[model samples]
Target: MTETRKQLLQELAAKNGTPLFVVDHEVLRNNFKEFREKLPDVQPYFAVKANSNPEIIKTMFDLGSSFDVASIYEFKLIYKNIETWPDKERQDFIWDKIIYANTIKPFKVLTKLNPYKILVTFDNIEELKKIKQRAPDVGLILRIRVPNTGSMVELSSKFGAHPGEAVDLIAEAIGMGLDVEGISFHVGSQCNNFDNYLQGLNFTHSILKEVALRNFEIGFTDKEGKKKKVLDIGGGFPVKYTPDVKSFSALAKKLNLEIKRLFGKDNIQVIAEPGRFMVATACTLVTKIIGKSIRDGKTCYYLDDGVYHTFSGQVYDHQHYPLHAFKDGELKLCATFGPTCDAFDTISLADELPEDLQIDDLLYAENIGAYTLASATDFNGFPVAKVAHINRENI
Candidate 1:
């Protein structure tokens, strides 16, 4: 964390009390602008599931950012905000700024949201049939499986259809009278393997080539009415949590080169669904030590918030947030845990902290905006972390 961020967090903690999440809107805007500058041609659809805070959504919406919604509630959230925009801007939001990216969705959600005419993704024929019956006119993107060996959270095993099976899925969609827009695949979350994305892009390119060879005009309409298609590169772009991790700009450079090499200078409508990368570094979680004990010849410091709160990403995303303990005493190895009855609420099994840490001592966790509060639960009587928003001017 920079000195600026630390001071900002200190101010927020002082004002809002402990167990607070401080979101800097300036950081969020800067992150999005950097992403756009790095990949100028790729349209970004912010994945709302990462941190669905309405303030964050409103910030992104004000920046003219698109959204990738997974559930009806998410769509409603974005819809509720974007509805307040100007009439023309609201129409654009209704038509083009959103994509329903969840392959498996509730039937009621599909039936009710079909009138919005937004883009959606599917993996199997059953999903296709459901979409056709419930939401026929919406644009469709086929979700294909790709390599995800090095990712922390492997999504391929659970989602995405095999490449061999996807060919028929496209053909079936065309046969059943569906709007086949393009192809999409997720390499995995926190994916460090650039090869996985290259492989997925190549697979999508080949599928488009095959469809073109068969004279199918669904996904191949270029800007000049020739040959081009949309490619939804599902998000897995890594953020710099630790020094060993590859920076976002480095990965973006590699992916951009591969995209140019594979598709040439064609006017392909490329888009990315970025969740973690968008908001991970934009917020910090501040929690205070409530109690401490020594067990099994080691120190254990309990925090007011844990896996059931803002640090939920530790259990869900397999993340070890960078922790900073505030004290001048000698350093000692300590274990951090949430203030919960469950033994599994440990935040870090092995962490270093100041030996003189007291009950009110605070610990700041950085890069915790994603998959944290969004997946948090009130398992015991403990409450969710209160969010404190810092606008650009304020930050």
Candidate 2:
């Protein structure tokens, strides 16, 4: 970070008060642009569950990005942007620009989503039956289970259908008078293992080929009347939170090459749900040291934001955001804790910082945009951090 940016963060913290989460819209745009540049063939659907801030969604909408919503609320958040468009335009937007990616959705949510006829994902026969009964008009994407090895958060254990059962499920969906648009899978969140993606692509390709052999036609026609099969390589695009985490460029190169080798001749419309990759590094959190103490000959600093608030990502995301002091001084190993009463609120016990820092001094963490604020809670009566955006004018 430059001195100018650090100074700006301090100014924002002072102006907005402590425990402030700052989002730089410029960074968000740059990240999205980079994703597009790297994977030109893949359509990025910003996963709203990562950071569902309205402004972030609006910025993404302005950038002509699609969305991947997990719930009724997130669906509404994206729909709010196009609520004023003409009836056809609104329906078209929902069909082309949004995907309800959650494999298991509530029956009420299915009923609510029926009118839009948007694309939704399913992994089991029960979900297919629910969709057929409640929202038969919606498009279906079969989510198959794949390897999630070496990912920060493993999701395959909870979601996705067995690869052996994938074909059967697709056949069942088609047999039920439903339109099976395509196949989808997630490697995992913050994935470092590139093989997982390759395996997922292979699985999807095999499944589609088998579906064709069975004489089952999948896909839908777009507004341009082009029949395209949707290939949703679900989210798991890794973010470089640490030096050891592999670069996205390397993954994109592998993906581009493998996608072409596997499905280049197929009429596949590739889309990706990228959550952490887009907003993880575009925001920062500034907190104030509320108290100082010494135990076991080690210094401990308590901040206004804790595990229940902005640092919640540490617990939920399995990632760390080391805090840094604005003032320069001799560095020493120290401990940091949140304002909460529970010992579980500890931020870091081995933070390296200046021991001479006093209470009310400001500290900040970078690349905390994803999963942190979205999972924050108001435990111990401490309110979540106040969000302030920069460079938000004119998109």
Candidate 3:
């Protein structure tokens, strides 16, 4: 952090009050541009579940980015942006720019999504049946279980069908008079093992080949009048949260080479759901120390935000955002806790901060824009962080 940045944060905190979340749209645009430049062939669907702030969604919309929504509420958030357009234009935008990426959706959601006729993902037979009966108009993408090893969050156990059963499920969907548009897979969230992606691509290739052998015609025709198959290489684009984490540029290079080597000649529309990569580093959280004490000869500081609020990402996303003090002093091991009564609200017991820091002093955490506020709760009568936008002007 620079002195200018620290001064700005302090000013923002003074004006907006503590437990403030600052979103920098300029950073958001740069992240989007980086993703596009690195992987030119793949279209990005900003995962709405990552941080469904309407302003963030609008920014992504303004950048011409597609969306991957997990629920009907999220679907409507994207729809809110285009509701004023003509009916044809609205529907076209929905088809082209939105995907209900949640593999398991409820019957009511299926019936609700049927009118849009957009693309959706499914992994099991029950979901397929529900989609066939309740939402037959939508396009389908089969999600196969791939290696989630060494990922920050493992998703294969809960989502994705076994790769071995992928083709059979596709065949069954087609037999039921439903359109199986393509195949999709998620290596995992914040994936560290790049080989997991390679294996996922190989699985998709083999499944598509088998589907071809079975003479099952999948995919839809694009405006170019060419038949194109949808190859949704689902979200797992790693973000460099720390120095040890691998770079997305390296992964993109590998993906470009492997995608071309395996399906170079195929008419495939490759897409990805990038949730954390887009917003993690684009925002920062500033909180105020409400109390100060000493425990076991170690300094303890309590903030207005905790695990149930702005710092919830620490508990849910398995990420650690080391808090920093604006005042310069010798650093020592300290404890940080949230405003909540439960000890479970502890942010960190090993946080390093100056021992002389006093109450009402400001501390901020960077790279906390992704999952923090999205999952926050107003537990113990403590309100979630107030969000303030910076660099929000159109670029």
Clashing pairs in 1: none
Tens-digit per-residue lDDT, 1-395, candidate 1: 66776777877888999899888899899989998999998888999999999999988888878999999999999899766678766765665689899999778988987887688999999999999889997889899999998988899998998998877888899999998888899999998888899899999888877877877756544335664567899899898888888788888898899999988765578999999989999988899999998899888899999988888898889888867875456678889999999988988877778867888888898888989999988889898999998875532
Mark the regions of model 3 whose C-alpha exceeds 4 Å error after superposition.
Answer: none
Clashing residue pairs, backbone N/CA/C < 3 A, model 3: none
Per-residue lDDT value at 142 in model 1: 92
Q: How accurate locally, in lDDT, is each candidate?
A: 0.86, 0.94, 0.93
Write down the TM-score of every candidate: 0.94, 0.99, 0.99
Models ranked on lDDT:
2, 3, 1
lDDT of 2 by residue, 1-395 (tens): 88999999999988999799999999999999999999999999999999999999999999989999999999999999999999989988998889999999989999999999699999999999999999999999999999999989999999999988988898898899999999899999999999999999999999888888988889999778888899999899998888999999999999999999999998899999999999999999999999999999999999999999999999999989999999999989999999999999999999999999999999999999999999999998999999999999775
Candidate 2 ranges beyond 4 A from true positions: none
Q: How do the residues 51-139 of candidate 3 rate in per-residue lDDT, one tens digit apiece? A: 99999999999999999999999999999998899999987898889999999898999999999969999999999889988999999
How much does candidate 1 score in TM-score?
A: 0.94
